[model samples]
Target: MGVIDWAIVAIYGVVVIAIGIIASRRQTDTDEYFRGSRQIPWWALGFSIIATSFSAASLLGGPGEGYTNGFLYLQLQLGDLLGYGLVIALLLPFFVRLNLTTAYEYLEKRFDAKTRSLGSLCFLLFVIARLGGLLYAASLVVATVTDLPMGAAILLVGVVSIAYTVVGGITAVVWTDVLQFAMIFVGIGAGIWTAVNGVPGGFGELWQVAAANDKLALFNFSWEPSSVRSLPTALFAYGILAFAVAGTNQQSVQRYVSCADEKSARKAILLGWFSGLVGVGATLLLGVLLFGFYSINGGLPADIAADGILSHFIVNAVPPGASGFLVAAIFAAAMSSIDSALHSLSTCITVDFYDRYVQARTNEKQSLRIAQILIVVWGIVGIGSAFYAASTGKDLLEFLVTYTTMFLGPLLGIFLMGVLFPRVNSSGAFYGTIAAVMLVIVGSNMGWLTFPGIWRSAITAPLGMLLGYGISLFGQIPPQRALQGLTLWHSSKQAQALGRPGLEEEVPDRGDY
Candidate 1:
């Protein structure tokens, strides 16, 4: 990167910090800090949701997948769309009506305290592990572009993200995400333009090269259960992966809960799908560009390994000033995810743990302080984990991504059992989660659950959910009033009151900056 690129990165950092400081004033209460006082514009929230979900993993990992494996990876996203649709149709209404602060709180309302706490604990572990990987990936991009030490770069990114997240809360996260999303598009567009302009045959030549190398093929339509990358596995297994991510994950669910109502939430979710499709398309295009650039140039630099395609091209292929912008774009991808994780983790700890146990009658000011402090604490933990991951010589991003999925199958199973199977008692849900998680661990160790050849993991959530529900069914009690009490889909005065516009009035909801 040239001096101009450094200037751009410095300016971007300043703008993000300023936004965080400005948003600090709005962090006067727990509700505002956690949910943005339910006042964010649906468009901004929608874009923010896209930005958060499209992490460094998506930006870099997607292209890497394309470069190595072809368009077969896009099949995973098919289930992703279905997952978001399901969330909009089912989960959004339930969360909006209840005015939830954290996603796991729904478990408490439907089951028992133990279920809620267990769910929250799973989310906490997943976010920290995943956020560390995001930070590591962004730091690696910085290291490649600017020739900085990876650990130092990781620390730098972590500190800047934490500075804003601790102050700005949800408001800062959403607004800054809009800017980050724009940066991502600009970077992708610039990369695509450069690729096309430099190539002899343009897009046609690019597609021919990819197809010649077996990178352009999309469908793998086959139903062999043991075949990992077959069409059936990509459609069904990846579908389950998408459902687990969009429907039950705290980070995605929190975005919906922050919306004003179910209608707005639905709109936001639908728009998010469009944003995701555009983002994925751009990422795939970038991969094709990298492939063409390398084929024409007789392959990449020696230091540019299999996983470093995007970073290497942006640094070596793009002009000096443009490299900086691409770096900023990479930073945007990482921060969008890390900041949201920090915000959600803090919210879960504060609302789910501190408020529920530490101080039941705490005032707004005290709640806000606890939340800010927890953000700092979790940020430090993530940074520490990044450093440890770096020293261990493991692929930080891959490790984080795989570890997070280990929890997803179980979490999805627990939630589905609670919501769809009313007979699944608190004990059943709790034990079912343990069993599903154990199966994941055991399967992974036995190599029966290795990551599929495709981009997404192959250990389908449906199998886990079915196993959990099956287990819960055996312990089912006969029809009783207890089942009726557990029915969240049934209407009540509380539900009707929640349906009213002034429901926030009855709750005296305090508010984010």
Candidate 2:
């Protein structure tokens, strides 16, 4: 890139760091650091959720999926709408009612300390793995453009994220994400305009090219187990992925808990659907455009890998200054996600581990310090993992999509049981979660169980949940007494009556906004 391009990237970086430092003033205590003292507006939080979830995966991976598979890949995203709806309808209310500081805290109250710790551990593992994949992807993009070593790029991204996150906390994360999301859209929009102008036939011609190449089709009706990309498998795998993202994932769930009440939380979730749809849809469309651009240009650069398609395009195709802006945008995507993961992981460790196990007497300031320290530690670990993953030459999308489910699916199953089935005891919930996780691992490794043949992975979590729930019911009697307690929505009402405004009121002892 030209000097102009480098300047654009540098400017974007400065703006992000500035925002974080500004937000840091508001984060004077643990609650404010972790959840922004629940003062963030629904719309801002909704956009932040979109920004966080989009990630480098969506920025690059979505287009890659489209370039290779066509519109049929969209089936996976369809499940998100349903997944978000379920979270709004069911999971949000339950979390709100509990006034949960960490999502795992609910597990502790309903089950046992072991159960809560187990859940937290699972999340911690998933976040580390997933964030490693994200950092790796971002590093690849930067390295591709600037010809830097992958390790250097990875360190640069990790340090920037850790610096802001440790200082500004969740408030910084939310506001910075808003700006990052805008930059991503700007880059994507510019790419799309350029592609459309260059192509002779516009979208119509592009569609024709895709159709001729068998990319326009959206479904494969075959039900046979042998097919890897059939309609059923896509739907089933996507459904599970959606459930994990919306209902079970701590990073996503934490955003809901950051809202003022159950009502606002639900609204934020629903609003996020529009952002998700548009963001994903644009990425996919850009993929089609990328395909046409490369096809007409007589194929991509010889060294361009499948996952590097979008990055390759940005560095080679976009104008000088704009190219750096796009590069910064990629960093923005990675940072948005990593920041959330850091905060969530720290929150889980502090609330679930330090507070519950090590020292019950710790005050809010002490807790915040502990969390900030954990964030730095995890950030280093994430960077190391990114270097390890880069050496494996794994496809970023496949590695992230498959490994994330290893733990998330079982967690989802256990949580579903806990909230939906009041009869389930701590013992049952504990054993049920374990059983579900084992089933997922066994099925994935052995390949004995398969659903929707095109989806190579086994439906372990869903099936395990089914089995675990069934096992729990064998000797347990249903509760004859009505479950007496406030639901998640009603908990908001209780908080309001108690003069909490559900989340708007800042706890004085906690400090800051």
Candidate 3:
């Protein structure tokens, strides 16, 4: 990389921090810090969600998967659309009407305290592993470009992300994400352009190479149970995975719930899905271009790992200034994910646990301070976990999908059981979640489950849902009073009739800036 590229990277970092500082001026309490006081425009929230989704996993891993296996991976986008639809249609009504701070709070309202606690814990495990993976992937990019040790690069990335998030909160996170998304768009466009121009006969020659190698294949209609790239897995299993992510995960739930209205939230989430599809598609195309570039040339180097190919290409093949912009995009992707996770994780700890249990009487100012402090603490812990993630020697994209399936599957099952099944009791949800997670762990270790990583959630979620519903049959049904406004079967009018609060809370108008 040349001086121009290094300068572009430096300016990007400074600008991100500046956005955080500027956003901090409007902060008056935890609401603004965590939810942007529910005043952020829908477009910003939608764009932030897309930016966070990119992470290092998509930025690097998407291309790697494309490079290695071609367009078969893009099938998962179909599942994503299905999942997003389910969440919007089935789940968002409850969340938006309740004005909940964290997604797990709904578990407590619908089920029992123990069930809520378990949900939060599952989310914690899921997001923490993701935080580590995102950080590790981004750090690998930095290390590759600057010749720094992995640990130092991890620290560098972690500190920059933590600095902005801890100060500006979600305000900083969403706005910076908007800027980062632009950088990512520019970076990926540059990468594709460079890769195409580098080929001997340009896109036509690249197309020939990709077609000859079967890299343009998109769908696999095979019914094999263990097939990871099969159409069924992408359409069905991946849909469940997407629902688990968009519907149940705190990081995702937090985004839409911050919107001023359900309509805005719905539009924002859908926009995120569409934008992410475009962004991810571009990255995958870049991967195909790389494969084409290498095939026509001498071929990819022997030592380059799947995850490292993008980084290696940027450093060696891209023009100097362009390489730096690509690096900046990678940083943008990493920080966007890290910041969102840190805020949501801290929100879980502070709202779900701390405010709910430890000191329920604390003023909003004190709670806000605690949330900020927790961000710093979790950021440090995430950095430490990144070292562990790097040692696991897994592909970045697959590594995240594996962990998401393992933890979120059962968690989403419990949420589904709560909303879709009115008969499920708190006891059933609690025990069912415990049983489902345990079985998944044991089954995978014992080699009893042999399907693709994405299939784990598809299998486990239904298992937990059925187990929960069955157990509920043997237990006392929850009173109709407690079910109001919590389940899909329960409407806001019914809640109001039963002397419960209606779906939407009337928050006083407040300035976001």
Best by lDDT: 3
- Best-performing candidate as measured by TM-score: 3
Give residue 507's error in model 1 in angstroms. 14
Residue-by-residue lDDT tens digits, candidate 1, 1-513: 779888988898889888888888767677787888899998888899889878876787767766767766666567678778767665676677768888787776666667788888888887887877888888888788768899789988899889989989899999999999999988787777777767788877877887788877777886754443467765666566667777777888888999998889988887887888788877876786678767876887676555588887886678867777778888999999999999888889988888877897999999888888998999999998777666655554456646666667667776777657766766677766776667766776899865542223234344545665666678755233223323454444544554532222222211100
Clash count, one per candidate: 3, 6, 1
Candidate 2: misplaced stretches above 4 Å?
A: 199-207, 224-230, 443-447, 450-458, 466-483, 486-513
List of clashing residue pairs for candidate 3: 97-503
- Candidate 1 residue pairs in clash (backbone atoms < 3 Å): 26-513, 32-511, 32-512
Per-candidate TM equals 0.89, 0.89, 0.96
- Model 3 stretches astray by more than 4 angstroms: 447-450, 498-513
